[model samples]
Target: MRCGIQSFFFLTLGGAETLLLTSMAYDCYVAICRPLHCHVRMGRRLCVLMVTGSWVMGSINSCALSIPYCQFRAINHFFCDVPTMVTLACMDTRVYDYMVFLSTILFFVLPLFGIVCSYSQVLLVVYRMSSAEGRWKTYSTCSAHLTVVTFYYSPFTYTYLQL
Candidate 1:
């Protein structure tokens, strides 16, 4: 039961955070790419929908990853995540590992791609801006967000992708 709860918490939290970051990337895209439409595009309704969708996606991910475990419970990792749980299980876990990898691609790699695309457009716009101050401000805003994203995703990628 504890392992189950841990899996639920870890997967749900990771997915929610990932999707929230993607939503923020979209917010940035709209703000920079469509400044005039920012008010309309990112209004209260849209923000709420984005946040709700993130949580829903997280829940769905956790549900989809609900693989039954065996009697053994010798968890060697700090957290009770999918990989560690699979390792501790008595049965073969190759198929489950593949599923985790596919989910990672869906939840992490795809969002990172979207973020990169958004930032690429933002970069183009900032490059074309006439005011030096505007360019600096945009760069500073994006740099801080990117730094936080790097800190969040790097360890996750390393932990999940490594053999």
Candidate 2:
């Protein structure tokens, strides 16, 4: 019971964080790529709704995933999770594995791809600017976002996708 509950919490947190990162990357892209319309596009109501929707989706996904593992209690690792739960459970996990792969694509791969594309467009726009000081300023702003993104994703990719 405890393992299942804790795993549920972790799943919810992971899903929420993934969505939050995706939203933040989009927000960054808009703020930099469309400075003129950013205010209108990223209004307070929209921001609030994005956050609320992230949490709601995260919660729903967690519920849908964890509800089935209630009876399976033997956690293989130090924590509860879909992988560990699937391994511990005595049933066919092919569907669960597929869901996990699809979620990884939706939540991790897509967001990372969008973040890269958004920043690439931002870079192209910044590159075309003639003002040295303005270009430097814009590049510096993107540096912070890129830094965090690189650090966050590099290890994740290495850990999961290594050959």
lDDT of each: 0.76, 0.67
What is the alpha-carbon lDDT for the whole of candidate 1?
0.76
* Runs in model 2 lying further than 4 Å from the true structure: 60-78, 159-163
Task: Identify the candidate with maximal lDDT.
Answer: 1
- Among all windows of 10 consecutive residues in model 2, the one with the lowest summed lDDT is 61-70
- Candidate 1: worst 10 consecutive residues by lDDT? 57-66
Tens-digit lDDT track for model 2 on 1-163?
Answer: 5664675576557656665666677777788778788778877887677567556545543433444643636555766555555665566778776776666666678878878788888888888888999889887877887787878778667744452
Model 1, 49-103: lDDT tens per residue?
Answer: 7567566545644543456656645777786776676666666677877877777
Q: So what's the TM-score on candidate 1?
A: 0.84
Candidate 2 residue pairs that clash: none
TM-score of every prediction relative to native: 0.84, 0.78
